[model samples]
Target chain A: MYEFLTGPMVWISFGIFFIGLIVRGVRYIRGLDWKLDRVTYGENISYGVRGAVRSILFWLFPYGTRSWRKNPWFTLWVFLMHFGILITPIFLLGHNILLKEKLGISLWTLPEAVADTMTVVVIVSVVFLILRRIALPEVRIITNWYDYVLLLIAVSPFLTGFLAYHRVADYYFWLMAHIISGHVLLIAVPLTKLSHFLLFFMTRAQLGMDYGIKRGGMKSKGMAW
Target chain B: MPEGTLCNKKTIDTKEQLQALLADKSGKEYYEQMNDLDVDRKALWGVIQKSLKSRTKTWLEICSHCGLCAESCFYYLANNRDPKQVPSYKIQETLGKLIARKADVDNAFMQKCMDWAYSKCTCCTRCGVYCPFGIDTGIMFSYLRGLLYGQGFVPWEMKIGSGMHRIFRAQMDITTEDWVDTCEWMAEEYEEDWPGLEIPVDKENADIIYTVNAREPKHYPEDIAEAAILFHVAGENWTVPSEGWEETSLAMFAGDWEAAKMQVESVYDAMDRLKPERMVVTECGHAYRATVIEGPYWAGLKTGKTPIDSLHYVEWVAEALRTGKLKIDPSKKIKEPVTYQDSCNYIRNGGLADVAREIMSYIAEDFREMTPNREHNFCCGGGGGLNGIGRYREQRNIGMKVKRDQILGTGAKLVIAPCHNCWDAIRDLEEVYKIGIRWSFLKPLLINMLEVPEHLKPKEE
Candidate 1:
């Protein structure tokens, strides 16, 4: 069970994540008739490209925008949580050790304490997000079971990984649970709201293209000083 | 005198003033008309299905409901940061659910969707600027409006305006004779100041075919006179068509593509007949956007193959000033520190923010800029035909708090709103908020400062 969870299941989850993304991307692209002539203000190809690039940069790094200042707490936690989520998975010493043991290839890994700290930060951020959904009346209205379930899905890998790393329970059992949770997250990434992981940059670029390229004679509102 | 000083004698409760305005006859009419419309669920869903294209579909799929766009909305801010007023929530509650459920919607749900789309949102697109996914909530809401329009559940003003356009070739229902007479009368009024001034109507092969909002002839004839005076002083050859003279497109606002097509086609046909070098839309934001940016596409005319180029009056004035064709006297510039309100269509959507500010600097001696000006400027609570839809008056006026504060912060006695809707919306804000600031259009200000050639100036006046 442990070998299957860590081996076949891992490959299966990776396949699902990548193949799901490809299918979604291809479907979206194929659905669009690329030749549809859009009547725009000014058709400057360079301007559109520049606008798309600008918007991509702005959204990827949203710290300076008005949205950041509006809700600094959400901004700070979200930034930290996203950073931790992306970083801890690839750069953690345990993950790197597994990569080296299995594939004979390894990337640089963070200090054990640092990895553990990041996992804690991510878990705390998810807790705050849940609380926010519950506490804020406005947010509470939009909150559904899916929102809570998604948050749980996001935090499970980190929480179980943290517990397993510290040997909180039966070492083999905890590690297997962590591996299974991570696989579930990987599989879910491309299938759910988690798809924003891949869709964010593309959507931002498309917006830049529409407002910047197709709508001619207009500066990119994203890049406007 | 130091800048940022309030010149008004009294303060008015803008909220109360707005409430009073909404309690008036037009407001009552809007409420009755909105409620009277029949709901056809299948037809409404059909419109939604038809309008759903790649861009809108992607927007629907990608919105994360982060609520980051809430701060960017004036309605959200003005209403004490209500999360329900957040732009995304509006989508979430209405369109999102419909798309999620794939058209299994009932009449009660459709009615709720209509109210949220029409009354709650102005489709301003300001929130789109701040949205992480760059989701244009405006475009999404516009599609929702298109669906609502299909169901024939539009605001009374839009219904009347589009109906008038279909029959009379003008939104305000001005007949050909009335349009021609109004132009002649306005020309005569301007002729009193500059003899030999000609407001040419349908002059064949003119350099410019100038068009105007119907409200100009119906209510603000002086704006027409101001444009004529400026054109005359600049020595440019411009003519207004007797037919299709109205540039405003209430049909576009109503999201009735068929009627919108007719409105644009009429303008194109009129311009094609005149064979003008270009068509110059007057200081109306939506009309300028419709005619210049969106019209050709709606009317199925290819951009390069189109007979006439479309230019906004702001762009035209800017170019005229740039080329020395139109001269302004520095000494005659507006005295009090004046601020400029960037019309959403002109600045954010059209990319004329810099040109507008340059024009403002040239004409106003003391030009103070409002905070978050230009593309980031708050809407005047009258965009997306909200000002025309009297049913949302209280909400619109309450939403004006953000803009009112922006103006008050500048302490500019006069606010120059180049777009007609912005001018009207800001004017209403002034009355309700009792901000005591006067509002003027760019045409009037340009007329005030224009340096008429010695031969054209009234002798010894």
Candidate 2:
């Protein structure tokens, strides 16, 4: 079970994620017809690039604009949650060791203490996100079964891995569960809302291009971009 | 509810009267218009398939349903934060569902979707600014509107207006004779001030061909007179086309691309014949957008080969002021505290907010800026052809409460809206809310403050 989880399953999930993203990205790029005459918010390419960069930087931080201020708790937790999820996968010691053992290449690793704390934060943030979906009426209306299922999928790997690392249950069973769930997540990223991780840049680029390039050199006002 | 005290009794009565005028249509007429279109799901799906470009696809996929865009919408903010009013929900309930179901939605669902797309959203694009990913809800809504329009689900006013433009070459069914007569009458009215002012019509090879909204002839002839006065004083070689004088494009608002193309082509054909070096559009927000920005694209003209240069009246006025051709009398400036409502098309879409404010500063003694002025300012709620659709009057009035509150907070006596639709929407708000404030078009205000030179002023007898 351990060999299958780390060998063919890992390759399968990685193949699905990387190839799926490439297909989606290529389709999106090929579909674009440059709207040379579309009216934009800015006057020139520099203005568009500036607005795009500003938008990216603003959204990268929590409470970046007044809109984000509406739900301060959600903003902070979600930001931290996303940060941990993204960073821990690449930098966690266990993941790096697996990479070194398998592929003979490994990135820098985070200390076990830091990795444990990040996994805990990710688990907590996922719980909060689920609570937010259930608690807020506006959010509740839009939430579907897929949303809850996706959240469960996102949280399982972190939860199981943390328990396994701390030896809270049978270590082999918990570790296997973690590896399988982690593969499920990798497969889900390109196929679900996790696609936002990649598509967000595309959305921001289109907006920046609109506000910056097509707008005839006018600077976007107060987050208008 | 806002914390402001209500205005005097006179203001309340005025508000009621204006609301009555807007909502005075018969129930029979509403029903008649509602049942005009037959729903064909397959045809509608085809329209959606054709309209799904990269931008729409990206916007649809990337939205995380975070509900962050809710606060950016005036409808959402003003209506006690209703989630249904959220821009994302509009996409989800209509286009999102359609995409999920492969555009196989039922007629009842399509009807509800059409109402949401047309009446619920103004397509102001303001919400996009606040979006974390800057997803343009306006573009998505427009694509939905285009789908509905292709299936013959357009509102009555838009259909009638587009029909008028297609048949008579104008909005509001103004005949060629009526247009010529109105121009002559406006020229005569302005001649009283300048004695020999020439409101030239159909003059070939003129420096500029000025076009106006049909409302200027039907309801607000004074706007035309003001433009004439400004043009006469500036000594511009401009002429109003006899054939394609009305510049407002209801077809564009209706999402009927073919009719929109025809409307634009009429102007292009006129410019082609007249050979004007430039086309100066009057102070109608949608007209300026459809003409200067979207006209060539819709009319199938090549990217860099537009027949004539299109300029908004705001740009023209600003340029005139800059070049000393039109001067503002600083002493004769408007004394009352004034605020400018940046029309969505002029500011958010056209990026002329700075030029508009600059022009306002030169004419008004005390220009009080609204809390969220310029591109970030709240829409007047009458854009996207909402003001023209009688069925959405109540929704429009309710949606405009945010703008009403913004104006009330400024404590300004007069509001200068640069676009006709903004002027109309703000006027309705002033009346509906009993705010007791007056509204004027920016052109008349500029005309009132403009200084005629000794050589141009009428000689005292």
Model 2 lDDT tens row, B1-461: 11112110111123333233225353344344344444556765676666676677777776777777777888888889998888888888888888778777665676787788877898898888778777888777876777776654556566556656666666676777888898899888778678778778899999989999988899888778888888888989999898878778887777766777777788888898899989899988999877766776676654422478778888898889889889988888999899988888868877788788778767888899997887788888898999988778888989999998899888897998878898989888877888899998777777777887887778888
Candidate 2 ranges with C-alpha deviation above 4 Å: A33-58, A61-66, A69-72, A215-223, B1-38, B302-306
Error of 1 at B309 (Å): 3.5
Q: Pick the candidate with the highest DockQ.
A: 2
Q: Which pairs of residues have clashing backbones in candidate 1?
A: A42-A216, B14-B432
Would you estimate the TM-scores of all the predictions?
A: 0.90, 0.90
Tell me the interface RMSD of model 2, in angstroms: 3.6
Q: Distance (Å) between predicted and true CA of A99, model 2? A: 1.8
Q: What share of the true interface contacts does each candidate keep?
A: 0.35, 0.39
Q: After superposition, how far is residue B455 of candidate 2 from its true place, in Å?
A: 1.2
- lDDT tens string, model 1, B304-400? 2235777788888988998888998878988888998888887887777888877876787888999888778888888888887766788889988
- The reply for model 1, stretches above 4 Å from the true place, is A32-44, A214-225, B1-38, B301-307, B459-461
